[model samples]
Target: MSNPLQLEVERLLALGRTPEALAAGEAMASDWARQGQPLRALALCRVLLQLEPAHTRTPQLLADLYARPDAPAKGAPPAAAATLPRVPLFSQLGREPFMALLGALELRTFKAGQNLITEGEPGRSMFALADGQVDVVRLLEGGERRTLASMGEGEFFGEIALVSESPRLASVVATRHTVALELIRTRLERIALRYPAVGETVRTFYRERLLANVLRSNPVFTTLPPEQRQALARCFELRLVDAGTVIIEQGQKGDGLYLLLQGQCTPVLRHPDGKQSAFSSLREGDVFGEISLLLGQPASATVRAETPCHLLRLGRDAFEQNLASQPRVRAALMRLGTERLLHISKLLSGRAALEGDLRV
Candidate 1:
């Protein structure tokens, strides 16, 4: 509440400018949404919606707040709220959301050597460990078991069930007598409908974790130091694009560097003969638009989503501030662009040779 936007909202309220205060508060809510403070964003959104129900951005804002992800949840940043800090999954929820979930949670007990969740079964709920220990295991394709992780008190698992009807990806077994709090998907989603800010909170946590994981594993980013990688992750904006969307146009300046998170994309170069040919396809974990962004030139190829795509974009201004300002990171990006360009050139040369033969 002490941030510039919060302060502005407070000052406007003090002056009895209720309409203006609500307006500024809405903007502050957006800041919270983007900064991994979803509960705060949700609380503010709820407040503004109540005050100005006709706000043009309500439906879309709420939809996005529920669906989109952002930077890592820092356990309530400046837009922080008083919330449960036990399970990292629900640790960032606002007071109302925490209370709503509290009512829906059921305490469950499991004896040692018992299954809490069996892999391949329908995932009906997610659980937060209240006491004791458990093991997370996955069934390998060869019929062997692989222990993925060990969970102790305050840890939670099986969250994807809350958002999707997907089957459980892994199994949880109690290593000892365990006490846990379970929230069924039916109940949890009821809260989502009632308080979409809760949706925003969950969305925030997901993106925060996802962005961190993606950056940590990205090929180019892996070369950067951990601290630098984290810094770069914070600057990225995750975007969703529909199939057939042209993200980068041939011969046009790229708006930013993009890292695909989901779906498929193709980079195609148009020849002088009014024909378009794909140079390569991009999939999850692939990076694009860097060559143009790094070299300060127009895009040499057009990149379009061949399937619905989720991507992380780092804008030019953000790049200048975080990546370009650091010599090592800048050089790494430059090297990547050079390597990709060389590959594209070879692909083009091969294509041209084939086309020339056909002309003969």
Candidate 2:
């Protein structure tokens, strides 16, 4: 059977590695012609000649790549053809505009088990995989490696690093021979200038995904309905709280709920007698300062960032405002609050029983 040379070429183009890609495209054309598959050969030839027109065979290939079957009307969209999953940027732009934008992008590819990103390195572009899978990895305290997750074709990553102008949080290693579409930050900024909505879409997508991840990890919110979960997500803002920062002060009116998205925090309780105790330590997905928000009272305890926490804060006023404007959001918040109350009540009751047993 003949190889899918055209598909392979598409993969390379998606990755923004054009120089070597041009050579691969030529090879595909040669192979196709050797197999007497003129149409396939012509498609690849067009791509090559587009890069280097003076190549002796350029004119003939150009004629063939543009050649049309008898039935189609002029200017009609090419007959429904198989294609890679649309990269997010192109998908957002639609057909004509996407193709227009593509003219300016470079193509690239990666071998299996290659690292696409590394922690602490500057990230100036985002990638969209057109084929193969990549593993998102991180190193642990003991130098042990862990797979945070894996993403496959049509999935996009490296976006947050570009948008936030921060170093990548996790490294991405290709698990299999891969081809990805890359959009440089400069190009993205240019597109954002022309189509601001695209930027908004990206931001909205980022926030929702981040919220969903944090919420999913907490037993408190994961059981809610999809619509409710989404509404709760909207009320939240993700913020990075530096280590040693005071996130909540005891005796101050609490206006927001804080969910740890990453890192840890220490909760401190101070008695009227001047006694102080470290009540608990929290890690990712743990939440604090929520009881005050729920009760509309002053904070009972202070919480300080222990190790540079990433937090998702949902302020009471914002929640109420969103509820007023969007009834569904209010419903979701109410449901979550009710569930949380029940959960805390159970925990408190269990602790009380343990104390009673100790006394006995």
Best by TM-score: 2
TM-score of 1: 0.58
- CA RMSD of each candidate after superposition: 15.1, 9.4
- Candidate 2 stretches with Cα past 4 Å from truth are 1-7, 10-106, 120-124, 165-167, 190-195, 240-245, 271-281, 306-310, 317-360
- Give the distance in Å from residue 107's predicted Cα in candidate 2 to where it truly belongs: 3.4
Please give the lDDT score at residue 323 for candidate 2: 36
Q: For model 1, what is the alpha-carbon lDDT of residue 241?
A: 82
lDDT of 2 by residue, 263-298 (tens): 778777665667665544777667666556656767
Candidate 1 wrong stretches, greater than 4 Å: 1-86, 106-189, 192-196, 223-231, 274-276, 351-360
| Model 2 whole-model lDDT (C-alpha atoms) | 0.60
Native-to-model Cα distance after best TM-score fit, residue 275 in candidate 2, in Å = 6.0
TM-score of each: 0.58, 0.61
Writing each residue's lDDT as its tens digit, candidate 1 over 1-360 gives 133433443454465437676767777767765665544454444445445655545324433333323422334233232231233654455545654565566656687899999987977887776556899998988899999889886566776566555567689999977766677888877899998888777655545655666777776677678787777777888677888999999899889988886678988877676776675578767778878877888998888889777788999898778777677666777776776676656566754322321100
Error of 2 at 328 (Å): 17
lDDT of each: 0.66, 0.60
